[model samples]
Target: MKDTKILKIHNKSDKPDNIVIRDNNLIEECIIIEKSLPNFMKDYFVYLKGSVSVSTRHAYLKDIKFFCNYLVESQELTIAKEICDITLEEFNLIKARDVNLFLGDYCTRYYKHTSQDTTLIYENNNRALARKKSSLSTLFKFMFRNEQLDSNITDGFNPIKLPKPQPDAIKRLDIDEVAKMLDSVENGYGLTDKEKVYWRKTKLRDKAILALFVTYGLRLNELRELNISSFNFSRGEFKIYRKRGKEVLMPINHTCEVVVKDYIYNERTKSELLAEEHKDALFLSLQNKRITPKAIRQLVKKYTSISMETSRDSGYSPHKLRATAATSLIQNGFSIYDVQNLLDHDNVTTTQLYAAHKKHVKRDIVNNFEWIDDKKETSLD
Candidate 1:
């Protein structure tokens, strides 16, 4: 079966959320043709007709483009003249064998390069390459449907088995390391007395952001989209409008709640925030506009750099904070099922990446499973 993730349009109906999968038997597989080609291609049309959000569409575009660049460079196919040069017929011809060969060769040639340097795979994985791949994939699919062929060549072809370079294992901060990092933030690159005061207030907001992500596993986008009114204090739940524009209420623990309360009551109020007519953005920059993703990233990087210096190897990224929260929750005896629900992952497998074996903790706790002799039998008398 083709393992596909379907996008659902958010409907604010009273009915409960339902997902509709559209792979394999979902559609009566057939091949058709048209006089004229599609604007993009067949694969892309499927995605567009489905409920994919803008960001998701953009990401798919990027991934496809990266693949396209590889095709162009490796095959020596000059497709820049007209986008149509990469037709469905052409795409199907490029098989899994080709993809596997390309990935193996690419990784072998250029794997360990640092961020400062450029390599073939690195260069092809940029935003532009993503768009190219997206457009190209759709074109291929369109041709399979419309272009006259013996059969559905696209379907006959095997799925690409690209190399997924294993990411660094999940690294989380202990309570002491988290505290030390927070303490060190007051001393950053350059701070005058005025800057120090400014940093103090900013630090509170930064700490709150990190604390929430670490404690709650909120995504960077989810946290950025939050408003002062997003939280219901009485219920201890914050409403998050997720990527697909679905509303989800995230329950918070006391620590995260405290940090949020402190940020709003003490720091955010004093930032001289100015909102545009439609701008109900929760997080604001010093200039008072809604904080951009880049700004948030920079803020995370700065704190992460400071945190790394204090001995935590993974540093303080928003994502690292999210991973930390997931790992920590699992280590504290939370089930993978509970973690999946809390993290709001659509798939259990996404949650399982963090749902790992607790080998280190088990070694320490295994002995304690047997009751102490003094405590075991005294109640019998």
Candidate 2:
């Protein structure tokens, strides 16, 4: 008797998709569908099941989306429609020249300043331009694997090199200027409603924030994340959580201890706070959530803007307060190691940036000068 063939169906057409014929008694044939493979391969990274954080996954997804958009906009490549049909020759045709041209044009178009002058060069000569190039380079590399483009296009693509701008020379607040600012804060003279609100609720907050930065050199993030529980008011010591989740504690002398205590007991007690959250959060916003990093940045910017209007000499930011702290500590003879640990720096080199203040260098130069001795001894020797 003749055996019938069996077919595996790939489509819903009248003909069988896969064919099987009798071998001894049975026969078989295989049918392959080429269409769905590209879509499956595009998301291959999602199947790995290895432990990675949500943020990392989000970043990867964002990078892939960026690449897909770039391909469509820059090269007329589409992941769903045109990607599978792309040949190796067609893939390689998407060149570094294209990427560079796209980036250069994109940077030039979006980076303009609004001073009514088209000829004015945008601030493209800095770190932002470099980062835009980096983002493009990274996205291209990701596309080559997932979207099946040539990964080599991104290879050897030189990143834009940007020279670091020299740090604005440290503008230290003089004692008299500090006194004047403090007087303005205390008396609330000639200040706006916003400034008055800042002056009232933020006296202790500002004092504590500034004192901590100027006294111990806290970063903006560190001050924002400070917890009341971390402070030992009796012992005058407070712990600060630094970047990348490290902690350091430094002692406050009696003067700062009084200020902090006064702030906590008198001013901070009135804040509306969130229940079921950490009550120990050292700084609270008006809405009573733990003070956020953005708030800290804004506070610094606002106060500094006000101070700048009063005295350019007091044009201070949180970073300047940090610098002020470093200079003050180094002026009072704090060891570099002490400053490094207090600031929770991973390397001594970063600490050295703060260490090389003009004041300390000048003081050392004057103290080491032998001009008086030379004049007294005369020329005979």
Candidate 3:
């Protein structure tokens, strides 16, 4: 006898009737998982789909899968062998202690597939554990609010307290370092003869990229997503899509405007690598496609490293460029509120961190102490 295949069908109303079938095995696996989920859990994910980004939803799914695996491996719950096998009643039966074990111990020893090979190995880190805890916490809160679970067991689990990140006092470039970086990119300084030749080809584009980072404090994604239409030459402004789906208009400084225009007209337009579809892109790779975030980071690192004296000074990424912009603005007497607006920070507190790191603040404090000491010494003399 032939085995019956379980097929998962999407609600026809939710999608177009003319569906092109592709990747049969992947479709089958998705169908199996969909069929396996309890109705309540399915509803929970459906509710989340309306609110969260695709990447965020993907994390939630992974975290929930890990929780289900814990039930089977640690608790020896036969019903939890498959995620769909776990019932709404079983979820309610989960105590605070069960959740604590999952968040603390299970997360610490979970297997991760290595990038170079298929071998799975245990990896434990505070960041990964904290993310899982947060994911589970979000899930439990959703379940409790929707009455899928009798109580929120995750509420009883203590927060994962990771150590504070060390301040990047040494990592941030001073004003002279920033000037040197821009000068090197423009003049091909510290570059080999071969590199200097390549730098001439990409100088305008590279300068525009660096200028945008220093001037606007754009996140990597925000910069990568830029199109030619994103800039308004007449209005002297540009639009950027920020985190959480925000679109904001930002003013372009005179330096950024000139460099970007020069690249667009002189270098970018002359490139034979530009593809038809990517013509709208503000930046293109050698392949003539929209430049990726990874490529942008590499470019930033390349120029930053050339400006540094040692490897210790060479770890600056695009984010550090963002920090540089914010700190520079704060040091030049821009209000924290203005810096927050420019950085597109939702909260003022985030901008305050940059303000706290202002080099001028430290300098002024030291100078005041010196003045006090000088007064005492003069009085004694």
Best by lDDT: 3
Q: What is the C-alpha lDDT of each candidate?
A: 0.58, 0.57, 0.75
Worst 10 contiguous positions by lDDT, candidate 3: 14-23
Candidate 3 per-residue lDDT, tens place, 122-232, comes to: 766888888888878887889898887888787688777886654455256667788998998889887778877878878888999998998888998788777887899
TM-score of each: 0.65, 0.62, 0.81
TM-score order, best first, reads: 3, 1, 2
Off by over 4 Å in 2: 1-68, 77-99, 111-125, 132-155, 165-183, 186-194, 234-236, 270-274, 292-295, 305-315, 346-349, 359-381
lDDT of 1 by residue, 1-381 (tens): 988754454546532222111121122121112112223455544644465654455444444555565566555544543343456456545654554455444523444345677543443443443344345445445555665333343343334434432223656666565565566554544334654665765776777777777778888878876776678889988887665657788887798788778877776644343543214445667666656777777666666655556423334667777777787888788988899888888988766776644555686687678665565445555
For model 2 the TM-score comes to 0.62
Stronger candidate by TM-score (1 vs 2): 1
Task: Kindly list the per-residue Cα lDDT of model 2 for residues 1-381, writing each as its tens digit.
Answer: 898653433355322111111111121110111231234334333432133333333344443343444464455543334434434454456678766765566544533346766554543454655655655555456556566564558765556766532324555554444555455555664467866876787777766665566677687766776667668877778776554334566787876787677778887844344453436667777666677777776655555545456542345677876766666676568887888877676787766666677456777899998666655545675
Best-to-worst ranking by lDDT: 3, 1, 2
